[model samples]
Target: MKRDIFLSELEILKGIAETLNEGTELKAVLGECLRKLLQLTSLEAGWIFLINQEGEYELVAAESLPPALTNPKHQALTQGDCWCVSRFRNGTLTKASNIMECKRLENARLGNWGDTYGLVYHATVPLKAGEEQFGLLNVAVANKEKFEAHELSILESIAYQIGTALKRIHLTMKEQDIKIVEERNRLARDLHDSVNQLLYSINVTSSAGIRLAKEQPIKEIMADIQRMSQHAQAEMKGLIWQLRPAGLEEGLACSVKKYGEMLGLEVDLSVEGISRLTTLQEETLWRIAQEAFHNALKHSGEHKVSVVLDYKQNTVVMTISDDGVGFDYAEGTFLPSMGLKGMEERVKCMDGKIIMNSKLGEGTTLKVELPIQQRGKC
Candidate 1:
């Protein structure tokens, strides 16, 4: 008889593990677990609760429960608390404990609202894993048989599995939150580099036009204003592209060309090899390219720019160059600006390198080299 009981308990534990692993949905997993518990222990009914963010217990799942126990007016599952739940809620009952008789059941029997069905005893187990407290698991039975130590141990093991599942779900939610924050930060950086700079340029151009109006030809001043207006339109389009993901879907090379065309610059793009990269790596390259292009447009005064993407067996290299006059790199006086620093930080975070080469009267070249297997490590 003892051997038969041990086999049954082992089978129940196997079923519980399978139930938790089979699904990622919390309520479905927990509901199935409660059902299996009732089958294994000969319990009449069972319920599981989850503590909300506000520290109140909420009914998450139940099985074979009586109507009186589930009624909203009675608030048996929602508001009212029995001795077992009260003890569990107050941190007094951290493990599976038997309640010889529940006040809730006794009160219902006395009031004659419904049949207690001989369910005078129940057990409560704190559903917890590590430091995470999910809520409580309750099971009731009609028989007067006292819960054995082994029975409580089985309950505790099942509760531990449930808690493990909940912990994974929690961590998954936190990861999603982190991704959202990262996206927001990317949008902020793009706006600052593109739209904000264009606005500043418009202000300076308008002021220059005011001064030139007194000395230069009206036709020339009008032409300058027209050019500035075109730049404004291009900036607006770039901002819209950043807001929407259409450019990203079209591929990085095509998107970069479109951005350059909008800005009225000649773009020469070259791809030497083909390879695959993670979405994050692709986005990083695209953003760094956009920043380099913006710098060329604003400072290089070059009519043409070149961008090259080279994919090798173990590494990918990017080169951005322009034909405009460049500054001297020998002067240690050229401190890194915010945009440059941001680019450098991004490259370093990915275990990459950024190299800049320039001399007076020569154009600047920016090179970025990144390992190909960075995503594989993740």
Candidate 2:
């Protein structure tokens, strides 16, 4: 019987681990987790309360509790009023019995109508990971019931499991956020270098041209205006490149090679058999190649670049490298002169790997590999 119970707990843990790792949002998963956790642990009512940015534990979800829980006045939850949540926020494990009497609830109104609720025992535990407390889990029941000592131990284990899992999810999200910021930064840089300067020059020259055009007597100055107009037209073409992805339908390799030729660089793009690839795989390859070409010309200032696409086992891979001065990528540093970080982020979103190999004067090579599972129509 003991072995059966242990196996059951393991199975529940497996289910929880799977659910948490499914890339589901933390709040949604935690709400669902509370229900499963309560059922698994044989608790009557369980709730997961998340601490807000202001450090208040607001009831996120409850499996069962006071019907009046819907009413704010009935819940004792207040700003900075939850001890378990606060503890978790600081990465501390805390457990308390008779949870209603906990410090946060002592001064709480708890709503006078829920007197029958007071007779039940409540336990509060911190849901902790790292040094941050994302929330608290509470188990409550009215009427006297004894909690087995082993049961409390198991609860502690569950809390630890929840904390570690939550930390992993948080880390993944943080990396994604950083990548998004990097992409935006790269786009801004592109505009500044390729579009902004040209437009600024055009504006200055156009103003001068208008002043000269006003003087019909100065035929020599008219030539200057005509020259400035040619520069403005060139700037407009650069803007068009910015407005549209130059090579998407033709494939990423095509885009990269086109971009290289446009920049007067010798670029060779290679593609192996991708007859079995879905559209998502092809698009991702295209984006990666596109970004790689942009990075080489605009950032590396390299005159030559190469892109290789291949399928190895279940992974689709794109490798782009250039013979330019390489910089340290391990520092997690984003140089304004380089858009490497932004390129890294886009690859990561596809559940891909971005490996940079470089040394000073040795040149830089970027390899992105992704496990392709079809997410769109073929």
Candidate 3:
């Protein structure tokens, strides 16, 4: 029996390592870790506390926790220091063998709710990678009891793995932020050189027109204004095209397909008669498709989604459809929910139209039509 238990615990740890290696988002990874730990170990309830930038251990994930433990008094433990937490903070609680019953639970049991969860003894492991400690991992079962030596070791190992994954996640987020800021700065510089300069020229021309009202021809000033206005429009479109979308550079179809895969959905993509599309048109279509895909996954509860990107003369048509429980979209009643309003606003900005087709218990389809080439672009 002991051998079998050891093997099962090892397998659970392996599964958790694989999940972290996949570069899954941090929150999802932490929740999955807690769940796997609960399933494999004697612990019935578990939670993870992560130290935020403010250096306070916040409850980021929990499983099977009772209402009393989640109440305002217990939540204050996030920012407040307790014996177990302080031991970890002071570098005394380094290993899982340093087991102790939680004073917080003892205090809560004395409260009006009356030991709502029966939570007493808990194993507190520091989430440490190298010299850095991210936070603490707490796991407990009902009543006061000591944990086995092997169990403590397993819990400690899992905490170390979580710490390592947290480090990677932190670095990944930092890199992404730096990239976004750099891209925005570059776009700002481009706008200043192109559109900003042109607008300034228009301002100068108007001032000259006012000064030379009798000497200058009104038609010439009007012509200058028209020329500058057209150029400004084109420049603005170019800038908008450069706005960020995770997988846009690859292609709109590819980006949407990858997005669905990330959401654990199979997306069938069909593209026809398109060698390439103008950046502005591609971006607008991509944003609308992204919003539609998110809505389908969140509210639709569908396993599979279908996407089609078709290019026709002077027009690009994209459709996203899902087979899930649909709602009655009256445009007024359901506009705010399911994020349809935001999608509509995006389409309007692109000077395009979005058609919604759905019925309760049927499905949803978002059909978008955008001009392939806007003013001054072929």
Candidate 4:
């Protein structure tokens, strides 16, 4: 009996591992895994939640939920707060254990919402990879008030596997995003180097032809050619700008200054020390600078902004400041707003640091520091 039980657990784990390894889409993977786990363990239901850094929890996967939880579009599970989630947000639920009772089920029973199928308790496990906590895995069985010790242990192991898989998927997605950005930049560079130069040469030659032509027809033809070339050149510039910032090849500072000017802002730009940055580093910095400039223009109530770029000790530092009105800046609360989260993600992808300071009625300042040596590491 012991050997059979061990083999059963092994088969369950092997099946789950294969499911996780073969999947890339997060919701689909979690749903399939939950289905398999519940079937193997004879549990009645399971669900998974993915919590972001902002303490927002999303119902990523669920399987075999009773009518009480699923009726009216999963209102019971998705809408209200539950004990496990509260504990998770408060940093109390760190391991797999039997929660005393399922709050949602109890509430359903009290409210006479629907049939719960005798589900009164659940096992909650924290999903984590190394030190990073992602979310929770919860499993419940009908008429079961508690889970066995070995059951909790197995759930813990499965949660760890799921967490690690989530980490891998996230990293893969990030890498793909980076590659897409790099490829777009490369295309922009090609257009600027080859097509843009050709258009410029055509415009110049047509202008010279108009100047030297003696016949009226010849001069008119040259003028028409010049106008067409100019229009095409402008369109090309717009396309390149969509792919990557203009003047970026000259330097990061130049690109940012030009962008600010285009946005109708008075940019006071200064540069110190020579910069040794990779293409990815330059791209990341330019993006962050653009976001800062945009925020200043929209929210700061000031037309003039200051930008400082400095390179020293193999690190590049940039500071963007606005003298207009600023809002209270709390790292935890404000990151998801004002496009700051996107900037933070870009910096993190490059293994860099970003800091922002702001206060009500005061101005805002954003600083970014990136190491030159971290280029290869990222």
For model 2, residues 145-226, the per-residue Cα lDDT tens digits are 4444555566666776777767776666656655754564467567767766776676576667667665665645655665
User: By TM-score, is 3 or 4 better?
Assistant: 4
lDDT of each: 0.72, 0.60, 0.69, 0.83
Per residue, candidate 4 scores C-alpha lDDT tens digits across 125-149 of 9999997788899988777777778
Cα error, candidate 3, residue 171 (Å): 0.4
For model 1, residues 1-378, the per-residue Cα lDDT tens digits are 232223476788887888788776667778888887777766678888775322446688899877667655666667666786667667787899888877777666666646556677777888888966778888876664466788788889888988888777656644554596468557856776777677667756776776667656774775677577667755655676555334556776787777777667899999888856655666667777777877888878897999998989877898999978887775333324568668765665455667887776898888888777651100
Best by TM-score: 4
> Model 3, 117: alpha-carbon shift in Å?
3.7
How many residue pairs clash per model? 0, 4, 0, 0
Clashing pairs in 4: none
Off by over 4 Å in 3: 1-7, 22-24, 52-55, 72-79, 215-378
Judge candidate 2 against the unseen true structure and give its global Cα lDDT, from 0 to 1: 0.60
Candidate 1 stretches with Cα past 4 Å from truth are 1-7, 39-41, 52-55, 115-117, 195-378
What TM-score, computed on C-alpha atoms, does each candidate reach?
0.50, 0.48, 0.54, 0.70
**lDDT accuracy of residue 21 in candidate 1:** 80
Q: What tens-digit string does per-residue lDDT give for candidate 3 at 134-193?
A: 778888766646676887788888988998898788667546645765686577667767
lDDT of 3 at 141: 68
